[model samples]
Target: MKLYHHPLSGHSHRVHLFLSLVGVQHELVEVDLVNGSHKKPEFLALNRFGQVPVLADGGTIISDSNAILVYVAKKLKLTDWLPESPAGAAEVQKWLSVAAGQIAYGPAAARLNTVFNASFRADEVIARAHDILAVIEGVLAERTFITGSTPTIADVALYSYVARAPEGNVDLQGYTKVRAWLKRIEALSGFVEFRKTPVGIAD
Candidate 1:
């Protein structure tokens, strides 16, 4: 398997982290986002969206980070990573939606502003980050993982951006439960961390 990714991208990091956790032997092909490599014709063939983190598993090509996570988990029969029951699947999907929506516009977007100099309202995005973190802190106070005791794709989905929220100037100082939850995920075997950038709060 080959993973086309950019180091600073949380979306790419989540998939890379999952692949490592599952012991999937794969090669990393770094996309030169700094030089418009992702927008070029060759890379566009893999993903019309011209995004990093496209997975090529022999003849099968998968785009989108969450979609890649689902495909790999299903193909590897990782029942714990992704439950099959209706209730469990629904719970996981709920968090995945949050990751794509609130998390994306919040912490992830904020990070993009600082790390890549993308245009985004830091005040608004940081506010959204705190709002979602408050909800997650409350949810995690009652359980070990986002959905339940065991970590799920939901956890993987939320991990990267939240872990690096500080880089977005979205402080993790107040949410004790959320901080602990991040540590728990880090303690997992074969865990790979998102590359830290000295920006935002660090600046």
Candidate 2:
């Protein structure tokens, strides 16, 4: 498996972390995101969206971070990371949706604004980050991990951006439970660290 990713991209880190957690032997293909490598025709062939974190497994090409997580979990038959039951699957999907939606527009967007100089209203995105973090804090207060006691693809989906939320000026200090939840995920075997960007609150 070859993972084409950029170090500063949270979306890429999400997939990288999951691959490590699952103890997969893979090659890391660091895409030259800063030099427009991802935008080149050759790269666009892998993903028309021209995004980092594309997984190339044999002849199969998987794009999108969440989709990659699903593919890896299913391919590995890691039912513990991705439940088989309908309810369990639905529960995991719900948080994956949040990772794609809220987590994207909130913490990830804000981090992009700071680290990559992407144009985004800092105040707006930071506030959005807090709103979602509060909800997560509440959810985590009642349980050990998202969706239930055991960690799932849902947790992997949410981990990178949330753990690095401070780089977006989205303070984690107020969300005690969320902070603890991040620590719990960190302690998991085969865990890999997301490369930090020294910006905003993280500075």
C-alpha RMSD for every candidate: 1.1, 0.9
Cα-based TM-score, every candidate: 0.98, 0.98
Q: Write the per-residue lDDT of candidate 1 for residues 114-185, one digit (tens) a residue.
A: 999989998999999999999999999999999999999999999999999999999998999999999999
Q: Residues 1-203, candidate 2: write the lDDT tens digits.
A: 99999988899999999999989999999999989999999999999999988999999999999999999999999999999999999999999999999999999998989899989999899899999999999999899999899999999999999998888888899899998999999999999999976688842
lDDT score for candidate 2 against the true structure:
0.94
Instruction: For candidate 1, give the lDDT.
Output: 0.95
Q: Lowest-lDDT window of 10 residues in candidate 1?
A: 194-203
